[model samples]
Target: MRRKILKVLALAPFALLFTSCEKKISHEHREVHWDRDMCERCKMVVSERNHAAQVINKETGEAYMFDDIGCVILWFKEENITWKDTASIWITDVKTSKWIDARTAHYDTVHQTPMAYGFSANEKKESIVKDSEILNFEEMSKRVLQRGR
Candidate 1:
């Protein structure tokens, strides 16, 4: 009827306004998406067990994938010329397939952990040091190994 058509027409503008005001979620934080064949860095087969890699991005969903923890740092320090907002480092547990934040992990001087970076081969446990305690490559090298060649 004409009344029904008028009711729908009146509601249409309000509906469009609500839809236009809806907040859009960014895809920047989505998990790493890539071909499952090989690591984009080391050229090794992407293994779900042994070594692992991850992609980090922000704002615009620009992802950068790597083969090892070392590679991740190396890529950030070298390859990625593009601007990045924030980065998340994904480290696989030596015993478990679970991923942990590498930026906030305890480093052991005796136990060898898989995919460990630099002298952190001796990682004791996961996230033992807390995020604030972690140091960058240059600083960690000086702290863990001392300043030298």
Candidate 2:
């Protein structure tokens, strides 16, 4: 009985140490279900392979999927997400349909998007016409906010 009590006490701190630590949240993009997963804001099925966006709360590592950048923009306004400035936004490259860092990717505002946002992300993978204007993340967000649609 004394040996059993000592063993329990010896392992208690290790158990406590493991349990007390907070679960680490991943800042990376989550897997998309494509045509099955619904948008967090608009509730539309995320079917557009090239236009889907996901915003991950940097602090909590929670990902909110969106069918369009327009929905993402409006969701920021509607929800007043406190972590907006620090959030990690992921968007698919227009040509490759692969996830890319949205904040760092260049955008051209000419394509027809799912939500009519008209902004397509580029990792320089999508060939643009000569002298086509490219917008940064901040600029694109401002334009989307200004459009107010």
Candidate 3:
């Protein structure tokens, strides 16, 4: 009995460490395996940490990952998705590498993005650059659609 209690005490820290090390994914965004999870539209690996995009169905909570924002836009057109208007779109901030709401982020059109849309998103306009063209989500989407990639 004494030996068993000592063993349990010795292993308690390891058990706690394992449990605490588990990553906690939030409801807003799902876990992504960079370079492993294939993009839904372009079929490219989402290896670009700053250019990856995610679209989630508002009702069903299904997430579609893309290697670039351009792929996400083209995917909606190709699939004829009806839930796009109500979906939650997420993109990585080029400066911080943090996930941000794509619809509300400011975009700069001078990056070597994965799909070559030349657009990169950031939460703050000042972070993008000084004297560069900045665009809202709607404007960016329109420009990307016009490109028709």
Candidate 4:
């Protein structure tokens, strides 16, 4: 009986470790503290509330924060990061500070951003700027990538 008890005690640590290793494999939006969190792309403090953006790698669950949507695009293109469908892209709505899926958010190119990308995100489908065209995530990314090239 003592030998059996010792064996169980020896396996307790391994069981604990195995159970603890079962972490959820998903990305979550992290809270950005203005003037505290720096942009991963520009290395500038993320001060903008509405233009803030975040990208999360699906496989690694690593998050990359940006001060502007333009910065996110530039970073992805410059790093040649693969934009996988499983990855999460978040952007702050211009009207509300709430996070929205970058792919579904409406993008306006006239609004001034922290990185001077002149792009902003909105939940509405219509473009707020009269002369500027509204773009989806792919269109905006292409526009920024083309400009970088």
Candidate 5:
């Protein structure tokens, strides 16, 4: 009886640890506070250190976030994203974490993220394109070299 009790006690900590380590997804509409330095979009508590963000049209304040670039593009395409009149688009560089234009983003076919696209901030790096020229789905397909389904 003593040995059985000790064994149960030893296993208790392991059970607790596993439960604590599990990811907690909230289905309720909880208020989210988003900081650019922390989360770029959705404003959820982002534990993923590799997260990135983009804001289109600072004036309009349109923005989006992604766990990875692929997720960002996937969300955009999946939702058939559309922009309002007189707006700009911006995206964060996974490396530098700086905001850049969305238009000039360099699309890489092969990346950890399927929608991996990046922009250069300065002359040294190619920044993502801003709202200087907005492209619709038709134009984007040609730029990314993929057909919009």
Candidate 6:
């Protein structure tokens, strides 16, 4: 009986350690604290509510937040991370201040952004300002990369 009790006691620490070491997988968008949260790319404080963007790695459940859509585009290329279907890309809609899937969002290059990439996302292509062409995610990314080079 004493030997069994000692064996059980020895296993308790390992069990606790295993549970404590287990990672809590979270892939959801976390609320950004404006002025407090810094952009992952430019290191600027995310003060612009409508320009904020985020990339969440669905596999690792890690999130990288940015101050603008332009910053996110730059970071996405620089990181050399695969743009898999599982990756979640989110952008703030300028008109509604709501989060929208960047894959389907339309982008305009006339709007002033934090990194001066002049890109903004909108739910509708018609919402884009005049003189700016509505770009899909791939087109916007290419434009941003081209401008960076």
Question: How high is the CA lDDT of each candidate model?
Answer: 0.49, 0.88, 0.89, 0.82, 0.42, 0.84
Stretches > 4 Å off in candidate 3: 1-27
34-127: candidate 6 lDDT, tens digit per residue: 8999998888999888888988998788888898887887786787778645788899998887999988999887778887887788989888
Candidate numbers, best TM-score first, in rank order: 2, 3, 4, 6, 1, 5
TM-scores for the candidates: 0.52, 0.84, 0.81, 0.80, 0.37, 0.77
Q: Give stretches of model 6 more than 4 Å off.
A: 1-26, 83-85
**Who is ahead in lDDT, 3 or 6?**
3
Clashing pairs in 4: none
Which RMSD values do the candidates have, in order? 6.7, 3.5, 7.4, 3.4, 15.4, 4.3
* Candidate 1 structure quality by residue, lDDT tens digits, 1-149: 99999999999999999999976644332354434645555565555442354656544445545545555555554566354335554555444545565555444333342334433421344533344343443454344333221
For this target, which candidate reaches the highest lDDT against the unseen true structure?
3
Residue runs of model 4 more than 4 Å from their true location after superposition = 1-17, 83-85, 126-132
Which lDDT value does model 3 have at 129?
80
lDDT of each residue in 1-149, candidate 5, tens digit only: 99999999999999999999976542222222344223332333433332343435344344444434333444555555564223344444444645555455443332243223321222122332344343433354455436322
- For residues 1-149, what per-residue lDDT tens digits would candidate 4 score against the true structure? 99999999999999999999986766778777888898997899998788898888978878888888888877876787776456798999886878998888888877777877676888887637577788888888888877762
Stretches of candidate 1 above 4 Å error? Answer: 1-35, 48-50, 81-85, 108-149
Candidate 2 residues lying further than 4 Å off, grouped into runs, are 1-21
User: What lDDT tens digits, residue by residue, belong to model 2 across residues 19-115?
Assistant: 8896888989999997999998889999999999999987878888999888998899988888888889999998889999999888987789988
How much RMSD separates candidate 4 from the native structure? 3.4
How high is the lDDT of residue 139 in model 6?
A: 93
Q: Which candidate is the best by TM-score?
A: 2
Regions of candidate 5 where Cα sits further than 4 Å from its true position: 1-51, 57-62, 84-87, 107-111, 114-149
Query: Ranking under lDDT, best-scoring first?
Result: 3, 2, 6, 4, 1, 5
Q: Supply every candidate's count of residue pairs whose N, Cα or C atoms clash at under 3 angstroms.
A: 1, 0, 0, 0, 14, 0
Query: Compared to the true structure, candidate 6 yields what TM-score?
Result: 0.77
**Model 5 residue 134 distance off true place after TM-score fit, in angstroms:** 21
Error of 4 at 52 (Å): 0.4
